[model samples]
Target: MSSQETEVLVVGAGQAGVAMSQHLTERGIPHLVLERDRIAERWRTGRWDSLVANGPAWHDRFPGLEFDDVEPNAFAPKERVADYFEAYAKKYNAPIRTGVEVTSVRRKDGESGFRVETSDGTVNARYVVAATGPFQKPVIPAVVPDTQGLAQIHSSAYHNPQQLPDGAVLVVGAGSSGVQIAEELQRSGRQVFLSVGPHDRPPRQYRGKDFCWWLGVLGKWEMAAPPKGAEHVTIAVSGANGGHTVDFRALAAAGITLVGRTNSFNNGTMHFASDLGRNIAAGDANYLSVLDEADLYIARNGLDFPEEPEARVLGDNPACVTKPLLELDLGAAGVTSIVWATGFAVDYSWLQVDDAIDAEGRPRHQRGVSTEPGIYFLGLPWQSRRGSSFIWGVWHDAGYVADQITIQRGYAAHVADVPLRQAATSAQSHTELSERIAVTQGA
Candidate 1:
């Protein structure tokens, strides 16, 4: 097979890879980015048709580049986000090879580099940056039984509401994807049964400012991951309808059936955990906590942001939470489709480096530096901070990783020069000894 060489090989030409390339280019690092598909492929293909960015444009972009012709406060469409990344890559002239899939990456035998096996050819690189962001694989719960005739798809594959079979839909999971799809289906005049789960209900806007603005001012974006046991609680904020807060009660009032955690499907009956009320209560508490923190921060900093009373008010408990429906007959409800917005799984099976992956299949790294030299990871959730996985945040993290790579290179060069330095010193001592011997003979 054909072989190519580069100082660095960045796998996956999405935002993370492109960002890393930009930083590496700034450092004059000769790197090649390999992508299985087009640049920003996920944003182009893996999202629902109506999906918009979860954060506002101003807060979610890389440095020195702004969303052209898009309002700062407005959430750009997924297509626009993809276009932005493509434009950014073009502007920097990132060395990206499209449709090149790296099948495996391993240490080169008896060498100080890596051998990357790709579909097109083999690449030898001194350093490899695994820039494949999270969401490598879509995961559907095992609880989803194999039922014939019920069209089920992960949110990644979902396009528009019209794509599903004409019937009531059961959306499992209440994260951003689940909630957004549920809301869209409901608005499309389809009965949506949303399985409510543990989630944070942060308002889209507060006090005439976008929620992202609040998070930025509060320094919440830079905060570490949520405390253990609450890591599963995803933020339920959406950028649809010019952006708005996601309220379960309001959704219930709007005709979407709010259900508890989907437990299992057995014998044509869908069982749900009796935690609807508790789940809703938890989300409400999370919502209030943000508002309270914002209020406290405003007062402490003497900021003039006004209070939003409507945001703080907890609406009436939906009947689903009050008198919970523990079970639902899918057939009776005419539920012909199931959208598993259950999120994605992390898979790094292709990385064959030793001591680089943990037992749980997560990258073993310190702020993106792997235990194995010359190997690194990028765009992992909380890789350095909570913002590590975000769009703009990934850019910052990539710069840091690039800095680490530069430091490592300098160190390696210094170590490589040690033997030469020692050899020169030995030669000078031998020459002095020879001259002394000759002087002794002459005397």
Candidate 2:
């Protein structure tokens, strides 16, 4: 087995991984990026054909590249964005080893470094950055009762309406993915039923102004300054994780029957929340209200508006009707295709670090540094700022982590002969000390 070495080893070659690699390379850090497949495989294979970014094209660009000659708010197709990433990698001359899958990463016994075992060979590194994004795993609800004779698919597997079975399609989960899939299915002349969940709504254009305008003005995409000591602020509403602003009202207006939360399925009947309309209406109201507040904030901040005669409060908005959660008889409704657009989960089984992750399976790190000394995470939702996981938000986190890694590697070089067991023990003691200080400060 051939053995190779680098200062840092970055896993994955998506937007986040590529961005991190770029930063590391620019800093003159000797690092190697290992990717399990070709670059941008998710965008090429996982996304639907008609799928465009929910946000603007300007927001989607990496650190140094522009999308097209068009305005920033233009919506670039998925393939175009993938092409941008590929170009970014070539431009930077990033040291990426493609088609190399990392099997395990364990601490080297006699050295303060890691032994990364891959299908091709092994790599010894001082630090490892896991840039594998959150969307690695697709989450399908366990509560969804299995049907005897129905085709079921997760949103990841769904490409277009043509893949759906010829019958009424019941889409579970009304998040952005669910709503988009449901809308597409409905447009295809399929009898589509959408299950309403906790979601937000926004018009395609808010008072003739693009929604991205407000987001930019409000500093929603700005990297938040890290909190002092251990004090951290919780996340407020933003574009990335809060919910998607889909034209649900338009979908409802178009004759799509909105259902409630999926409770269970029995005898081919899907049960849903009785107050489905109420939930949808409430969600719409809250989102509009937030946008209204955002508009006010923008005006107060003396920002120029794209739309003249800025939008005013419509009026006292009525709470949407919520019918009692009910069940849909799938067999009676002739439901053939069930698309579970529920959401995604993060899976790190391939990652060998166990102590650094939390109960929710998220990396237990302040910003990106894990409890372990040399392991780090990037591309997590709200990882640093409101939009850390967003295309625009990732650069700051990537740069910060890269700098920290470089600094730490400098310190490690002076003590490279330290034994692994001693280093692990010291790391644990430091973590404990930090926790104690945090608790003391809180008290």
Q: RMSD to the native, candidate 2?
A: 7.2
Tell me the tens digit of each residue's lDDT in model 2 across 182-232.
Answer: 877888899888877665454445644555655566665564653353122
Model 1 clash number? 0
Best by TM-score: 1
- As a whole number from 0 to 100, the lDDT of residue 97 in candidate 1 is 92
**lDDT (Cα, tens digit) per residue for candidate 1, span 1-443:** 38998889999988999999999887666789999999999999989998899999998898878998789999999999999999999999999999989999999898788999999999999899999989899989877566557899999999999899999999999988999999999999999899988888887888888888888888888987677898777778899878889988888998999889999888778999999998989888888888888888888989887767877778679777799889999999999999998888889999998988989888989989999899999988888887786898899899889878766554454466445333222223434434433543454
**What are the lDDT scores of the predictions, listed in order?**
0.86, 0.71
Q: Estimate each model's TM-score.
A: 0.92, 0.83
| Candidate 2 lDDT score at position 239 | 31
Quote the positional error of residue 33 for candidate 1 in Å. 0.6
Global CA lDDT of candidate 2, please?
A: 0.71
**lDDT score at residue 404, model 1, on the 0-100 scale:** 80
Error of model 1, residue 153, in angstroms: 0.5
- Residue 328 local lDDT, model 2: 74
Best by lDDT: 1
